[model samples]
Target: MCDAAETRPGIDPDRLSFTIALQTAADQIVNASNITGSDRGIAKAVLADPLPARRPRISARKVKCPMSRYGTTPHETRPLTSRSLTHLDITVLAAAEQPAVLPPSPANTDRRSRVFRLLAAADPGQDWTARQIADALEIGHLRSLSAQMGQWITQKFLVREGRGRYRLHPQWAKTPGDSLDSTTTIPA
Candidate 1:
């Protein structure tokens, strides 16, 4: 059941809600201490403070343009003036500079290319350890390079002659369709 006398025009709903929240906080502070002499007095003073009145609501139509007070319309435009060449300076320099070299292709800098270059430059009978290859190519991770070298040997890209040494696959060094192992020469 609703009471018709409960609502009051002087008491705003927003102010009532704010008062309720403040009352709850005050209650907590007052009940927290058993010796509530000074603390209770402070909470009481806080709760007794008058609630702020609800701000006046402005409708879109009722809102005044801020620019109207200045007696000037918002964003007034002015005509642009033509530019005049009052001062000018110029300089010329020789164009004998060397042409910029193109950056190396991604393939040329890849791990496969590095490995191929290293092996191709080695003597036919010479074998390279993983550390040697890594050191020559400035690769920091030895173990990882060693693993990749092993994989290359398994893929027949390189030959694993011994424990750590590797050589370019003999077939790659030989001419196409030439399977003779004795005739295969070292790559230039």
Candidate 2:
């Protein structure tokens, strides 16, 4: 029931608005119906049947751990000073700290990278098989690697000495692409 005594006698808009709102909220709670479903449903859930949830006795700072975030045992790191170290361990650690120079593009994206790595690993004047290149690079698509050889063929980047074998063309590597121009990136 609206507080009629609280309502002003004449042309009282504010009390009427409050009366309407109180009735709307109570009506929604009884139906468990989301009238306008914004904050109303949450308020309905709370007020309709006010029940307490069982929460564990825990604090934020105490729960802040790497294992807690990942929920894994293996990832839990020990304090650095607690561990014992050897001379080789120190050397390996120092070497690991130095950043490795990665190849320019994404490692497994382009076939050119896999081909280059395979060629670099091969002996001075020896040719590498398409399967061998695929195996060496741990790449699944041997056909794509074979297709890359064809690209090298069209570009004249390497001499495809027939039947899937490619040898580095010394002349192509040495010659610059641009005519009398500087700041041009020549093909490697």
Q: All candidates' TM-scores?
A: 0.37, 0.33
* Candidate 1 residue runs with Cα over 4 Å from true position: 1-105, 174-188
Model 2 lDDT-worst window of ten: 5-14
lDDT of 2 by residue, 34-147 (tens): 656565443333343322433432322233466643232343454423334445533444445668888696333455644554464455377767787788778897787788
- Tens digits of per-residue lDDT, candidate 1, 49-139, equal 5357766433222225655422332343432333466898888888898999998864355676677766766675688898889889899
User: Which whole-number lDDT from 0 to 100 does residue 9 have in model 2?
Assistant: 32
Q: Rate the local accuracy (lDDT) of all candidates.
A: 0.60, 0.52
Best by TM-score: 1
RMSD of 1: 16.6
Clashes of each: 0, 0
The alpha-carbon deviation from the true structure for residue 22 of candidate 2, after best TM-score superposition, in angstroms, is 72
